[model samples]
Target: MKDVEDNGLKNDAFLAAAASELEQMVEQICERIGTPLHETTELQRQVLAAFGFGAVYSITHRDRLTEPQAHALSIRMLIKPFNYSEQQAVDFVDDLIRVASNEEVHPLMNTIIHRGINGHVQFAQEDYEAMGRNIQEILAAVQQ
Candidate 1:
Protein backbone atom coordinates (compact mmCIF):
# COMPACT_ATOMS: atom_id res chain seq x y z
CA MET A 1 0.00 0.00 0.00
CA LYS A 2 2.80 2.41 0.84
CA ASP A 3 4.57 1.60 -2.41
CA VAL A 4 1.41 2.22 -4.37
CA GLU A 5 0.90 5.54 -2.65
CA ASP A 6 4.47 6.59 -3.42
CA ASN A 7 4.08 5.57 -7.02
CA GLY A 8 0.90 7.56 -7.32
CA LEU A 9 2.59 10.63 -5.94
CA LYS A 10 5.48 10.21 -8.37
CA ASN A 11 3.08 9.89 -11.25
CA ASP A 12 1.27 13.04 -10.21
CA ALA A 13 4.47 15.00 -10.02
CA PHE A 14 5.61 13.71 -13.38
CA LEU A 15 2.33 14.66 -14.97
CA ALA A 16 2.47 18.13 -13.50
CA ALA A 17 5.99 18.66 -14.80
CA ALA A 18 5.07 17.34 -18.20
CA ALA A 19 2.06 19.61 -18.39
CA SER A 20 4.17 22.62 -17.56
CA GLU A 21 6.78 21.74 -20.14
CA LEU A 22 4.15 21.12 -22.76
CA GLU A 23 2.53 24.44 -21.95
CA GLN A 24 5.81 26.24 -22.54
CA MET A 25 6.50 24.32 -25.70
CA VAL A 26 3.03 25.07 -26.99
CA GLU A 27 3.56 28.73 -26.25
CA GLN A 28 6.75 28.79 -28.24
CA ILE A 29 5.18 26.92 -31.11
CA CYS A 30 2.31 29.38 -31.17
CA GLU A 31 4.73 32.28 -31.31
CA ARG A 32 6.71 30.70 -34.08
CA ILE A 33 3.52 30.05 -36.02
CA GLY A 34 2.34 33.63 -35.40
CA THR A 35 -0.71 32.38 -33.52
CA PRO A 36 -1.89 33.81 -30.23
CA LEU A 37 -0.86 31.73 -27.23
CA HIS A 38 -4.30 32.00 -25.61
CA GLU A 39 -5.96 30.72 -28.73
CA THR A 40 -3.56 27.83 -28.97
CA THR A 41 -4.19 26.88 -25.34
CA GLU A 42 -7.95 27.04 -25.84
CA LEU A 43 -7.72 24.94 -28.96
CA GLN A 44 -5.57 22.42 -27.15
CA ARG A 45 -8.10 22.17 -24.36
CA GLN A 46 -10.93 21.74 -26.83
CA VAL A 47 -9.04 19.07 -28.72
CA LEU A 48 -8.17 17.21 -25.56
CA ALA A 49 -11.72 17.45 -24.33
CA ALA A 50 -13.12 16.23 -27.61
CA PHE A 51 -10.60 13.54 -28.54
CA GLY A 52 -8.44 12.88 -25.47
CA PHE A 53 -4.67 13.06 -25.17
CA GLY A 54 -3.89 9.77 -26.87
CA ALA A 55 -5.27 10.77 -30.25
CA VAL A 56 -3.76 14.26 -30.38
CA TYR A 57 -0.27 13.05 -29.45
CA SER A 58 -0.36 10.34 -32.08
CA ILE A 59 -1.07 12.58 -35.08
CA THR A 60 1.25 15.45 -34.15
CA HIS A 61 4.25 13.18 -33.63
CA ARG A 62 3.54 10.49 -36.18
CA ASP A 63 5.42 11.73 -39.24
CA ARG A 64 7.58 14.73 -38.49
CA LEU A 65 5.83 16.33 -41.44
CA THR A 66 7.96 18.10 -43.98
CA GLU A 67 7.26 21.44 -45.62
CA PRO A 68 5.28 19.71 -48.34
CA GLN A 69 3.13 18.07 -45.73
CA ALA A 70 2.50 21.40 -44.08
CA HIS A 71 1.67 22.99 -47.42
CA ALA A 72 -0.76 20.21 -48.24
CA LEU A 73 -2.54 20.81 -44.97
CA SER A 74 -3.33 24.33 -46.09
CA ILE A 75 -4.43 23.45 -49.61
CA ARG A 76 -8.14 23.49 -48.87
CA MET A 77 -7.91 26.89 -47.23
CA LEU A 78 -6.08 28.16 -50.24
CA ILE A 79 -8.64 26.79 -52.66
CA LYS A 80 -11.60 28.50 -51.02
CA PRO A 81 -11.85 31.02 -53.84
CA PHE A 82 -13.13 28.26 -56.11
CA ASN A 83 -16.79 27.21 -56.20
CA TYR A 84 -18.00 24.08 -54.42
CA SER A 85 -21.37 22.41 -54.57
CA GLU A 86 -23.59 22.42 -51.51
CA GLN A 87 -23.41 18.67 -51.27
CA GLN A 88 -19.66 18.75 -51.53
CA ALA A 89 -19.51 21.29 -48.73
CA VAL A 90 -21.83 19.26 -46.52
CA ASP A 91 -19.86 16.13 -47.26
CA PHE A 92 -16.73 17.99 -46.24
CA VAL A 93 -18.23 18.93 -42.89
CA ASP A 94 -19.31 15.38 -42.32
CA ASP A 95 -15.83 14.23 -43.07
CA LEU A 96 -14.35 16.63 -40.51
CA ILE A 97 -16.82 15.52 -37.86
CA ARG A 98 -15.81 11.94 -38.47
CA VAL A 99 -12.07 12.45 -38.53
CA ALA A 100 -11.92 14.89 -35.68
CA SER A 101 -13.28 12.18 -33.49
CA ASN A 102 -10.71 9.55 -34.41
CA GLU A 103 -8.62 8.60 -31.41
CA GLU A 104 -5.40 8.26 -33.34
CA VAL A 105 -5.44 11.40 -35.45
CA HIS A 106 -7.53 13.95 -33.58
CA PRO A 107 -4.61 15.59 -31.79
CA LEU A 108 -2.62 16.16 -34.94
CA MET A 109 -5.75 17.37 -36.68
CA ASN A 110 -6.38 19.81 -33.85
CA THR A 111 -2.81 21.01 -33.94
CA ILE A 112 -3.07 21.58 -37.65
CA ILE A 113 -6.04 23.85 -37.05
CA HIS A 114 -4.43 25.62 -34.11
CA ARG A 115 -1.29 26.33 -36.05
CA GLY A 116 -2.71 26.88 -39.50
CA ILE A 117 -5.64 29.15 -38.70
CA ASN A 118 -3.34 31.74 -37.09
CA GLY A 119 -5.60 31.71 -34.01
CA HIS A 120 -7.17 35.00 -34.84
CA VAL A 121 -10.56 36.18 -33.53
CA GLN A 122 -13.68 34.31 -34.41
CA PHE A 123 -13.40 33.75 -38.10
CA ALA A 124 -15.85 35.40 -40.49
CA GLN A 125 -18.23 33.31 -42.55
CA GLU A 126 -15.78 33.11 -45.43
CA ASP A 127 -12.99 32.18 -43.08
CA TYR A 128 -15.11 29.56 -41.41
CA GLU A 129 -15.95 28.14 -44.80
CA ALA A 130 -12.28 27.96 -45.67
CA MET A 131 -11.50 26.27 -42.36
CA GLY A 132 -14.25 23.76 -42.90
CA ARG A 133 -12.88 22.96 -46.32
CA ASN A 134 -9.41 22.62 -44.87
CA ILE A 135 -10.64 20.34 -42.10
CA GLN A 136 -12.33 18.09 -44.62
CA GLU A 137 -9.26 17.86 -46.79
CA ILE A 138 -7.01 17.20 -43.81
CA LEU A 139 -9.20 14.44 -42.44
CA ALA A 140 -9.42 12.75 -45.84
CA ALA A 141 -5.68 12.77 -46.24
CA VAL A 142 -5.07 11.59 -42.68
CA GLN A 143 -7.56 8.79 -43.12
CA GLN A 144 -5.72 7.63 -46.18
Candidate 2:
Protein backbone atom coordinates (compact mmCIF):
# COMPACT_ATOMS: atom_id res chain seq x y z
CA MET A 1 0.00 0.00 0.00
CA LYS A 2 2.79 2.36 0.87
CA ASP A 3 4.58 1.67 -2.41
CA VAL A 4 1.41 2.25 -4.38
CA GLU A 5 0.84 5.55 -2.57
CA ASP A 6 4.34 6.67 -3.31
CA ASN A 7 3.92 5.80 -6.97
CA GLY A 8 0.72 7.77 -7.14
CA LEU A 9 2.43 10.79 -5.71
CA LYS A 10 5.20 10.51 -8.27
CA ASN A 11 2.67 10.27 -11.09
CA ASP A 12 0.89 13.36 -9.85
CA ALA A 13 4.10 15.31 -9.71
CA PHE A 14 5.02 14.16 -13.19
CA LEU A 15 1.67 15.25 -14.61
CA ALA A 16 1.82 18.67 -12.98
CA ALA A 17 5.29 19.29 -14.29
CA ALA A 18 4.28 18.21 -17.79
CA ALA A 19 1.25 20.52 -17.80
CA SER A 20 3.32 23.47 -16.71
CA GLU A 21 5.92 22.84 -19.37
CA LEU A 22 3.32 22.43 -22.09
CA GLU A 23 1.52 25.61 -21.10
CA GLN A 24 4.71 27.61 -21.26
CA MET A 25 5.64 26.15 -24.64
CA VAL A 26 2.20 26.93 -26.03
CA GLU A 27 2.50 30.51 -24.94
CA GLN A 28 5.90 30.78 -26.56
CA ILE A 29 4.68 29.24 -29.79
CA CYS A 30 1.77 31.64 -29.96
CA GLU A 31 4.09 34.53 -29.37
CA ARG A 32 6.54 33.47 -32.05
CA ILE A 33 3.87 32.59 -34.61
CA GLY A 34 2.15 35.96 -34.05
CA THR A 35 -1.18 34.25 -33.53
CA PRO A 36 -2.98 34.06 -30.27
CA LEU A 37 -3.90 30.63 -29.02
CA HIS A 38 -7.62 31.06 -29.66
CA GLU A 39 -7.01 32.03 -33.28
CA THR A 40 -5.19 28.83 -34.19
CA THR A 41 -6.46 27.21 -37.35
CA GLU A 42 -8.13 23.82 -37.29
CA LEU A 43 -5.00 22.15 -38.60
CA GLN A 44 -2.83 23.93 -36.08
CA ARG A 45 -5.13 22.85 -33.30
CA GLN A 46 -4.86 19.26 -34.51
CA VAL A 47 -1.11 19.40 -34.23
CA LEU A 48 -1.38 20.90 -30.76
CA ALA A 49 -3.64 18.06 -29.69
CA ALA A 50 -0.97 15.55 -30.69
CA PHE A 51 1.69 17.56 -28.91
CA GLY A 52 -0.41 17.64 -25.78
CA PHE A 53 -0.70 13.87 -25.67
CA GLY A 54 2.96 13.33 -26.47
CA ALA A 55 4.04 15.82 -23.85
CA VAL A 56 2.12 14.10 -21.07
CA TYR A 57 3.19 10.59 -22.03
CA SER A 58 6.83 11.50 -22.46
CA ILE A 59 7.02 13.44 -19.22
CA THR A 60 5.39 10.67 -17.20
CA HIS A 61 7.74 8.02 -18.63
CA ARG A 62 10.79 10.22 -19.08
CA ASP A 63 13.11 7.99 -17.08
CA ARG A 64 12.00 4.80 -18.80
CA LEU A 65 11.49 5.96 -22.39
CA THR A 66 14.37 5.88 -24.82
CA GLU A 67 14.85 8.64 -27.38
CA PRO A 68 13.40 6.45 -30.09
CA GLN A 69 10.49 5.51 -27.89
CA ALA A 70 9.63 9.16 -27.23
CA HIS A 71 10.04 10.09 -30.87
CA ALA A 72 7.83 7.23 -32.02
CA LEU A 73 5.14 8.23 -29.55
CA SER A 74 5.03 11.81 -30.87
CA ILE A 75 4.98 10.59 -34.45
CA ARG A 76 2.10 8.25 -33.71
CA MET A 77 0.10 11.08 -32.20
CA LEU A 78 0.82 13.47 -35.07
CA ILE A 79 -0.08 10.91 -37.71
CA LYS A 80 -3.09 9.37 -36.04
CA PRO A 81 -5.77 11.36 -37.87
CA PHE A 82 -4.20 10.81 -41.29
CA ASN A 83 -4.89 7.06 -41.55
CA TYR A 84 -1.61 6.32 -43.28
CA SER A 85 -0.54 2.68 -43.81
CA GLU A 86 1.90 1.08 -41.39
CA GLN A 87 4.90 1.33 -43.69
CA GLN A 88 3.96 4.79 -44.92
CA ALA A 89 3.44 5.97 -41.38
CA VAL A 90 6.84 4.66 -40.35
CA ASP A 91 8.49 6.31 -43.32
CA PHE A 92 6.77 9.63 -42.76
CA VAL A 93 7.47 9.53 -39.06
CA ASP A 94 11.10 8.84 -39.83
CA ASP A 95 11.26 11.83 -42.12
CA LEU A 96 9.60 14.02 -39.56
CA ILE A 97 11.96 12.92 -36.80
CA ARG A 98 14.95 13.30 -39.07
CA VAL A 99 14.13 17.00 -39.19
CA ALA A 100 12.83 17.24 -35.65
CA SER A 101 15.46 19.41 -33.99
CA ASN A 102 16.15 21.52 -37.05
CA GLU A 103 14.16 24.15 -38.96
CA GLU A 104 13.18 21.65 -41.63
CA VAL A 105 10.49 19.72 -39.77
CA HIS A 106 7.71 22.29 -40.37
CA PRO A 107 7.56 26.05 -40.06
CA LEU A 108 5.11 26.03 -37.15
CA MET A 109 7.21 23.23 -35.73
CA ASN A 110 10.09 25.66 -35.83
CA THR A 111 8.26 27.85 -33.33
CA ILE A 112 7.48 24.88 -31.11
CA ILE A 113 10.29 22.58 -30.12
CA HIS A 114 9.89 18.99 -31.23
CA ARG A 115 11.20 17.60 -27.95
CA GLY A 116 8.25 15.61 -26.67
CA ILE A 117 8.67 16.08 -22.91
CA ASN A 118 11.87 18.07 -22.49
CA GLY A 119 10.15 21.35 -23.51
CA HIS A 120 13.32 22.92 -24.83
CA VAL A 121 12.30 24.94 -27.92
CA GLN A 122 14.48 27.48 -29.66
CA PHE A 123 13.60 30.05 -32.28
CA ALA A 124 14.99 28.68 -35.51
CA GLN A 125 14.58 31.98 -37.37
CA GLU A 126 12.22 34.90 -37.45
CA ASP A 127 11.18 34.35 -41.05
CA TYR A 128 7.45 33.72 -41.14
CA GLU A 129 7.38 32.94 -44.86
CA ALA A 130 9.82 30.09 -44.40
CA MET A 131 8.12 28.52 -41.41
CA GLY A 132 5.02 26.86 -42.92
CA ARG A 133 6.71 25.37 -45.98
CA ASN A 134 7.01 21.89 -44.56
CA ILE A 135 3.43 21.78 -43.38
CA GLN A 136 2.29 23.02 -46.76
CA GLU A 137 4.19 20.21 -48.43
CA ILE A 138 2.68 17.66 -46.10
CA LEU A 139 -0.80 18.99 -46.74
CA ALA A 140 -0.23 18.96 -50.49
CA ALA A 141 0.97 15.38 -50.33
CA VAL A 142 -2.04 14.35 -48.30
CA GLN A 143 -4.43 16.00 -50.70
CA GLN A 144 -3.11 14.05 -53.63
Candidate 3:
Protein backbone atom coordinates (compact mmCIF):
# COMPACT_ATOMS: atom_id res chain seq x y z
CA MET A 1 0.00 0.00 0.00
CA LYS A 2 2.81 2.39 0.92
CA ASP A 3 4.57 1.59 -2.34
CA VAL A 4 1.43 2.30 -4.33
CA GLU A 5 0.96 5.62 -2.55
CA ASP A 6 4.55 6.64 -3.25
CA ASN A 7 4.20 5.71 -6.92
CA GLY A 8 1.04 7.78 -7.25
CA LEU A 9 2.78 10.78 -5.71
CA LYS A 10 5.68 10.36 -8.12
CA ASN A 11 3.33 10.15 -11.07
CA ASP A 12 1.57 13.34 -9.96
CA ALA A 13 4.88 15.14 -9.64
CA PHE A 14 5.92 14.05 -13.12
CA LEU A 15 2.66 15.28 -14.58
CA ALA A 16 3.06 18.64 -12.87
CA ALA A 17 6.56 19.02 -14.28
CA ALA A 18 5.39 18.06 -17.75
CA ALA A 19 2.57 20.60 -17.61
CA SER A 20 5.00 23.32 -16.56
CA GLU A 21 7.34 22.43 -19.39
CA LEU A 22 4.55 22.50 -21.92
CA GLU A 23 3.57 26.03 -20.80
CA GLN A 24 7.15 27.16 -21.17
CA MET A 25 7.33 25.74 -24.68
CA VAL A 26 4.13 27.54 -25.64
CA GLU A 27 5.51 30.82 -24.25
CA GLN A 28 8.69 30.36 -26.26
CA ILE A 29 6.72 29.66 -29.40
CA CYS A 30 4.62 32.80 -28.92
CA GLU A 31 7.74 34.89 -28.40
CA ARG A 32 9.45 33.40 -31.42
CA ILE A 33 6.40 34.10 -33.55
CA GLY A 34 6.49 37.81 -32.55
CA THR A 35 3.16 37.61 -30.73
CA PRO A 36 3.15 39.67 -27.57
CA LEU A 37 3.53 37.41 -24.56
CA HIS A 38 1.40 39.49 -22.20
CA GLU A 39 -1.24 40.59 -24.67
CA THR A 40 -2.69 37.30 -25.86
CA THR A 41 -6.26 37.59 -27.05
CA GLU A 42 -8.97 35.50 -25.45
CA LEU A 43 -9.53 33.65 -28.71
CA GLN A 44 -5.85 32.85 -29.00
CA ARG A 45 -5.78 31.57 -25.44
CA GLN A 46 -8.87 29.45 -25.99
CA VAL A 47 -7.49 27.96 -29.18
CA LEU A 48 -4.24 27.05 -27.51
CA ALA A 49 -6.02 25.59 -24.53
CA ALA A 50 -8.25 23.54 -26.78
CA PHE A 51 -5.31 22.20 -28.73
CA GLY A 52 -3.50 21.28 -25.55
CA PHE A 53 -6.51 19.47 -24.23
CA GLY A 54 -7.10 17.76 -27.54
CA ALA A 55 -3.55 16.50 -27.75
CA VAL A 56 -3.56 15.14 -24.22
CA TYR A 57 -6.96 13.61 -24.60
CA SER A 58 -6.18 12.09 -27.97
CA ILE A 59 -3.04 10.52 -26.64
CA THR A 60 -4.60 9.23 -23.43
CA HIS A 61 -7.91 8.18 -24.90
CA ARG A 62 -6.72 6.87 -28.21
CA ASP A 63 -9.46 4.29 -28.56
CA ARG A 64 -12.32 6.62 -27.66
CA LEU A 65 -12.09 8.81 -30.76
CA THR A 66 -13.25 6.64 -33.56
CA GLU A 67 -12.87 8.09 -37.05
CA PRO A 68 -16.30 9.70 -36.95
CA GLN A 69 -15.84 11.00 -33.45
CA ALA A 70 -12.52 12.58 -34.30
CA HIS A 71 -13.94 14.16 -37.40
CA ALA A 72 -16.85 15.64 -35.48
CA LEU A 73 -14.58 17.07 -32.82
CA SER A 74 -12.31 18.63 -35.42
CA ILE A 75 -15.27 20.17 -37.18
CA ARG A 76 -16.61 21.66 -34.00
CA MET A 77 -13.22 23.11 -33.08
CA LEU A 78 -12.70 24.59 -36.52
CA ILE A 79 -16.06 26.30 -36.81
CA LYS A 80 -17.18 27.36 -33.35
CA PRO A 81 -15.75 30.88 -33.49
CA PHE A 82 -15.55 31.60 -37.18
CA ASN A 83 -18.20 33.12 -39.42
CA TYR A 84 -18.18 29.95 -41.49
CA SER A 85 -21.52 28.53 -42.50
CA GLU A 86 -22.22 25.11 -41.10
CA GLN A 87 -21.77 23.46 -44.47
CA GLN A 88 -18.48 25.24 -45.08
CA ALA A 89 -17.25 24.22 -41.66
CA VAL A 90 -18.29 20.66 -42.30
CA ASP A 91 -16.45 20.60 -45.59
CA PHE A 92 -13.29 21.96 -44.12
CA VAL A 93 -13.49 19.56 -41.23
CA ASP A 94 -14.01 16.64 -43.54
CA ASP A 95 -11.01 17.64 -45.60
CA LEU A 96 -8.74 18.09 -42.61
CA ILE A 97 -9.76 15.11 -40.56
CA ARG A 98 -7.48 12.71 -42.39
CA VAL A 99 -4.47 14.02 -40.50
CA ALA A 100 -5.71 12.37 -37.34
CA SER A 101 -5.69 8.91 -38.87
CA ASN A 102 -2.62 9.17 -41.01
CA GLU A 103 -0.38 6.15 -41.27
CA GLU A 104 2.64 7.87 -39.81
CA VAL A 105 2.08 7.79 -36.09
CA HIS A 106 5.48 8.61 -34.59
CA PRO A 107 5.46 12.26 -35.65
CA LEU A 108 1.80 12.76 -34.86
CA MET A 109 2.40 15.15 -32.00
CA ASN A 110 4.54 17.50 -34.06
CA THR A 111 2.08 17.38 -36.92
CA ILE A 112 -0.83 18.12 -34.62
CA ILE A 113 0.96 21.05 -33.01
CA HIS A 114 1.94 22.56 -36.33
CA ARG A 115 -1.51 22.09 -37.80
CA GLY A 116 -3.22 23.58 -34.75
CA ILE A 117 -1.08 26.70 -34.78
CA ASN A 118 -1.40 27.15 -38.51
CA GLY A 119 -5.15 26.66 -38.44
CA HIS A 120 -5.54 29.10 -35.56
CA VAL A 121 -3.49 31.76 -37.34
CA GLN A 122 -5.29 31.30 -40.64
CA PHE A 123 -8.77 31.42 -39.11
CA ALA A 124 -8.02 34.27 -36.73
CA GLN A 125 -6.41 36.41 -39.43
CA GLU A 126 -9.34 35.92 -41.78
CA ASP A 127 -11.84 36.48 -38.97
CA TYR A 128 -10.18 39.76 -38.00
CA GLU A 129 -10.27 40.99 -41.59
CA ALA A 130 -13.93 40.04 -41.92
CA MET A 131 -14.81 41.76 -38.66
CA GLY A 132 -13.06 44.93 -39.80
CA ARG A 133 -15.00 44.88 -43.04
CA ASN A 134 -18.26 44.33 -41.20
CA ILE A 135 -17.53 47.20 -38.86
CA GLN A 136 -16.70 49.48 -41.75
CA GLU A 137 -19.87 48.53 -43.59
CA ILE A 138 -21.94 49.17 -40.49
CA LEU A 139 -20.32 52.57 -40.02
CA ALA A 140 -20.92 53.56 -43.64
CA ALA A 141 -24.55 52.48 -43.45
CA VAL A 142 -24.97 54.42 -40.21
CA GLN A 143 -23.48 57.57 -41.72
CA GLN A 144 -25.68 57.43 -44.82
Candidate 4:
Protein backbone atom coordinates (compact mmCIF):
# COMPACT_ATOMS: atom_id res chain seq x y z
CA MET A 1 0.00 0.00 0.00
CA LYS A 2 1.20 3.50 -0.75
CA ASP A 3 1.95 5.79 2.16
CA VAL A 4 -0.89 8.25 2.61
CA GLU A 5 1.47 11.22 2.75
CA ASP A 6 3.62 9.88 -0.07
CA ASN A 7 0.56 9.98 -2.29
CA GLY A 8 0.85 13.73 -2.43
CA LEU A 9 -1.90 14.43 -4.93
CA LYS A 10 -4.60 12.41 -3.20
CA ASN A 11 -3.52 13.51 0.27
CA ASP A 12 -3.60 17.14 -0.66
CA ALA A 13 -6.96 16.75 -2.28
CA PHE A 14 -8.34 15.01 0.79
CA LEU A 15 -6.94 17.68 3.11
CA ALA A 16 -8.43 20.41 0.98
CA ALA A 17 -11.79 18.74 1.07
CA ALA A 18 -11.51 18.24 4.81
CA ALA A 19 -10.65 21.89 5.34
CA SER A 20 -13.52 23.03 3.17
CA GLU A 21 -15.85 20.80 5.16
CA LEU A 22 -14.53 22.32 8.35
CA GLU A 23 -15.13 25.81 7.03
CA GLN A 24 -18.66 24.94 6.02
CA MET A 25 -19.25 23.42 9.45
CA VAL A 26 -18.13 26.63 11.07
CA GLU A 27 -20.40 28.67 8.81
CA GLN A 28 -23.36 26.50 9.68
CA ILE A 29 -22.53 26.80 13.37
CA CYS A 30 -22.35 30.58 13.19
CA GLU A 31 -25.69 30.68 11.39
CA ARG A 32 -27.17 28.51 14.09
CA ILE A 33 -26.00 31.15 16.56
CA GLY A 34 -28.20 33.58 14.65
CA THR A 35 -25.39 35.50 13.02
CA PRO A 36 -24.47 35.21 9.40
CA LEU A 37 -20.76 34.48 9.02
CA HIS A 38 -19.94 37.77 7.34
CA GLU A 39 -21.99 39.78 9.81
CA THR A 40 -20.69 38.18 12.98
CA THR A 41 -18.98 40.45 15.45
CA GLU A 42 -15.23 39.95 15.76
CA LEU A 43 -15.61 38.10 19.02
CA GLN A 44 -18.39 35.94 17.67
CA ARG A 45 -16.25 35.00 14.72
CA GLN A 46 -13.45 33.91 17.02
CA VAL A 47 -15.87 31.88 19.11
CA LEU A 48 -17.28 30.28 16.01
CA ALA A 49 -13.80 29.40 14.80
CA ALA A 50 -12.94 27.86 18.11
CA PHE A 51 -16.22 25.99 18.05
CA GLY A 52 -15.50 24.73 14.58
CA PHE A 53 -12.05 23.47 15.46
CA GLY A 54 -13.40 21.95 18.61
CA ALA A 55 -16.12 20.15 16.69
CA VAL A 56 -13.61 18.76 14.23
CA TYR A 57 -11.18 17.73 16.94
CA SER A 58 -13.92 15.92 18.83
CA ILE A 59 -15.18 14.14 15.78
CA THR A 60 -11.70 13.01 14.93
CA HIS A 61 -10.92 11.69 18.39
CA ARG A 62 -14.24 10.33 19.59
CA ASP A 63 -16.25 7.46 18.20
CA ARG A 64 -19.87 8.16 17.30
CA LEU A 65 -19.94 11.51 19.08
CA THR A 66 -23.35 13.14 19.56
CA GLU A 67 -24.01 16.81 18.88
CA PRO A 68 -24.46 17.55 22.58
CA GLN A 69 -21.11 15.91 23.32
CA ALA A 70 -19.54 17.94 20.56
CA HIS A 71 -21.18 21.08 21.96
CA ALA A 72 -19.79 20.36 25.41
CA LEU A 73 -16.39 19.76 23.88
CA SER A 74 -16.63 23.04 22.00
CA ILE A 75 -17.16 24.89 25.29
CA ARG A 76 -14.14 23.18 26.80
CA MET A 77 -12.07 23.81 23.73
CA LEU A 78 -12.94 27.53 23.85
CA ILE A 79 -10.67 28.19 26.82
CA LYS A 80 -7.26 28.14 25.14
CA PRO A 81 -8.45 29.66 21.88
CA PHE A 82 -10.09 32.55 23.74
CA ASN A 83 -7.51 32.76 26.57
CA TYR A 84 -10.26 31.95 29.06
CA SER A 85 -10.01 30.18 32.35
CA GLU A 86 -12.28 27.20 33.11
CA GLN A 87 -14.85 29.31 34.86
CA GLN A 88 -14.53 31.83 32.10
CA ALA A 89 -15.26 29.12 29.59
CA VAL A 90 -18.51 28.43 31.36
CA ASP A 91 -19.24 32.16 31.49
CA PHE A 92 -18.42 32.47 27.83
CA VAL A 93 -20.79 29.66 27.03
CA ASP A 94 -23.47 31.46 29.02
CA ASP A 95 -22.79 34.71 27.22
CA LEU A 96 -22.84 33.07 23.81
CA ILE A 97 -26.06 31.32 24.65
CA ARG A 98 -27.68 34.55 25.82
CA VAL A 99 -26.80 36.29 22.58
CA ALA A 100 -27.92 33.28 20.58
CA SER A 101 -31.11 33.10 22.61
CA ASN A 102 -32.06 36.51 21.37
CA GLU A 103 -31.48 35.16 17.86
CA GLU A 104 -33.33 31.86 18.49
CA VAL A 105 -30.08 29.92 18.57
CA HIS A 106 -30.80 29.55 22.26
CA PRO A 107 -32.63 26.28 21.76
CA LEU A 108 -29.51 24.59 20.46
CA MET A 109 -27.49 25.89 23.37
CA ASN A 110 -30.21 25.21 25.95
CA THR A 111 -30.05 21.45 25.72
CA ILE A 112 -26.32 21.43 26.29
CA ILE A 113 -26.00 24.33 28.74
CA HIS A 114 -26.53 22.17 31.78
CA ARG A 115 -24.27 19.46 30.45
CA GLY A 116 -21.31 21.13 32.18
CA ILE A 117 -18.02 22.08 30.57
CA ASN A 118 -15.88 21.72 33.65
CA GLY A 119 -14.67 18.21 33.00
CA HIS A 120 -11.23 17.46 31.58
CA VAL A 121 -11.05 17.00 27.83
CA GLN A 122 -8.61 14.23 26.99
CA PHE A 123 -8.58 15.61 23.50
CA ALA A 124 -6.74 18.63 24.80
CA GLN A 125 -3.58 16.54 25.00
CA GLU A 126 -3.89 14.60 21.74
CA ASP A 127 -0.82 14.41 19.54
CA TYR A 128 -1.50 15.84 16.11
CA GLU A 129 1.39 13.91 14.56
CA ALA A 130 -0.16 10.68 15.73
CA MET A 131 -3.54 11.72 14.41
CA GLY A 132 -2.05 12.52 11.05
CA ARG A 133 -0.29 9.21 10.99
CA ASN A 134 -3.51 7.43 11.83
CA ILE A 135 -5.52 9.19 9.16
CA GLN A 136 -2.88 8.31 6.61
CA GLU A 137 -2.95 4.70 7.67
CA ILE A 138 -6.73 4.58 7.45
CA LEU A 139 -6.70 6.13 4.01
CA ALA A 140 -4.01 3.78 2.76
CA ALA A 141 -5.92 0.77 4.08
CA VAL A 142 -9.18 1.85 2.49
CA GLN A 143 -7.58 2.55 -0.87
CA GLN A 144 -6.08 -0.95 -1.03
Candidate that beats the other on TM-score, 2 or 4, i.e. the better one? 2
The number of the candidate with the highest TM-score is 2
Model 1: per-residue Cα lDDT at residue 39: 47
Q: How many residue pairs collide in each prediction?
A: 1, 1, 0, 0
Candidate 3 C-alpha lDDT tens digits along 33-57: 4465346555454334334334333
In the range 95-135, model 1's lDDT, one tens digit per residue, is 44455456365566555545333322112222444433443
In model 1, which range of ten residues has the least summed lDDT? 74-83
Model 2: residues with Cα > 4 Å off, grouped in runs: 51-61, 65-144
Candidate 3 regions exceeding 4 Å error are: 57-144
Winner of 1 and 4 under lDDT = 4
How do the predictions measure up, each by TM-score?
A: 0.34, 0.44, 0.39, 0.37
> Candidate 3 vs candidate 4: which has greater TM-score?
3
The 0-to-1 C-alpha lDDT of every candidate, in the order given, reads: 0.38, 0.48, 0.44, 0.44
RMSD score of candidate 1 (Å) = 15.6
Positional deviation of 14 in candidate 1, in angstroms? 1.5
Q: Which wins on lDDT, candidate 1 or candidate 2?
A: 2
lDDT (10s digit) by residue, model 2, range 1-144: 999999878755644454455565555555655666578666665555434443534453654645654555445444443344567667755655544445655655433333333333121233323323433343344346
Q: What overall lDDT, based on C-alpha atoms, would model 1 receive against the true structure? A: 0.38
